[model samples]
Target: MTPPGPCPRPLSRALIVAEARRIADEEGLGSLTVRRVARRLGTGQASLYRHITDRGQLLSLLAGDVALRLPLCADRGDPRERLRDHWLAAHDHLARHLWAARVIADGEHAVGTAAAFADGALGALAEAGLDPDDAARAHRVLWNLLLGHLLNAHPVGRTGTPRRHGDGSRSDFSWALSRVLDGVLAGQPAGGRWRLGR
Candidate 1:
């Protein structure tokens, strides 16, 4: 019966990844499975397996793909501003891919992009006179704080509260982020001598 005639055109890995990410963005990670992805791609499950071995590998690739978009800079500028911008960008990214954050937080996924971000942040902190170890620790602490705050401030499936702010609206996320950043900056040894006073 012509043996499928070489299958017309090969499935694009990029397309598959994009589609998978979209599904996760829309439906959450729990709904992302091999069968579901194949259905969304309009292809056979086996075809997807040819590109991705399992869900773990797929999630890793997805997280790394998202992480690559993080704005990691090395200008040696103000650590507080740099950190604020970094965390803000991360918050925006995580907000977009809520499922990814859920999966990563659950320890079901590993993020290559997150590691790159951490390395960049740590280097920047070190360049700002923070000790190497302290820089790393500080980055971790900031990330966790931001993640926790964001997750708590905006829980899933709550539609009553507003998501964004307007001219007269309160900036809950911004306020929380600023407070966290203030704490981090205050605790640093360089410009944070006041922290020891308290």
Candidate 2:
């Protein structure tokens, strides 16, 4: 006899993305096949294909979805504080979703979602008196810095709780972030001439 149809309501594309993201989080991105996602969603591979064109498209959609979840320029007084908070939040999010970081590292831009993050960060740097070029370059530098630190600090295949390195109970994040900002600020022109030191 033929098998019964899938329960009642059909799964939405959002549900598929969520399930795929969960699988990536649990089993790493390598295991995120259409068949694997369909198995997780209790549906057939054809049903998944209806929403996602292929594995690449599905991963891009999932990355974009997760990118949207990142915090965006929330107020906390002081541009520096805001910037630090923003970077730390991004750091935390990427650390939790390491595969998302890998996708970004591989040069996958999620268009609208990722651009919002870049715009917000660069705007904050501009507000802090960085020139347009400096602001843009600073944004790129900070992103790379945070991603590199997190990836190295929390390597894959290691078990147990993650640890943050610092000296005498101080947060390395705070120290490193402050130093970066200070360096940027110091690079600003003084009396219409670029000055290296105060």
Candidate 3:
């Protein structure tokens, strides 16, 4: 008989993350516990600690991993359109991985993975004359809008995915984004300072 293949390699961080992500995707982010992941991997729960510090770290890692797949803003374009496109793409990305928005909402994990996208958005706004403070505030508002839209999409039997309404959810986001951007960019002078009525 052929000699048995070399013993499988010991558990690794990559393997652990993969299994944990699988758990999160198949079940839900709440189900991604060390014990559950270890049980699925045929390893003791304690073994996972060697690969991850805790569940919080696991959630952060998952969020960052997902964020890396999101689209980045175009280097050259109309600032308003760039912002609109970036947020729209982000909304679509989160809709596909609905669990990711939950991880982001739980903790600010998407920040690290989204560094490029963030910089792009900031740069585009700066080009459009938005001061740093205003840009940051706008960023927060857009981020909230994106997350809320994804989370509020009624699930088909609460499945871990957003259900599309009439026309399409994407179109809805685009429409909202345009109006929000108009408000954000309105009343701007050469210096880009804008104010909204309370």
**Candidate 1 ranges beyond 4 A from true positions:** 1-9, 74-76, 153-170, 187-198
Could you say which candidate leads in TM-score?
2
The candidate with the higher lDDT, 2 or 3, is: 3
Expressed as tens digits, the lDDT of each residue in 108-162 for candidate 2 is 6554687778888887776676878988999988888876665564435435665
lDDT of 2 at 174: 59
Best by lDDT: 3
A best-first ranking of the candidates according to their TM-score comes to: 2, 3, 1
Per-residue lDDT of candidate 3, residues 1-198 (tens digit): 343342256788878877777788778787778888877777777888887999888888778778787889887767787788889888887777778887788775645778887888887787666889988888888888887776665655444445553226677678888898889888654333244551
Q: Which stretches of candidate 3 lie over 4 Å from their true place?
A: 1-10, 108-110, 153-168, 187-198
Model 2 ranges with Cα > 4 A deviation: 1-9, 153-171, 187-198
Overall local distance difference test of candidate 2: 0.74
Worst lDDT 10-window in candidate 3: 189-198
| RMSD of candidate 1 to true structure, Å | 6.1
State the lDDT at 126 in candidate 2. 69
Residue 71 lDDT, candidate 3, scale 0-100? 87
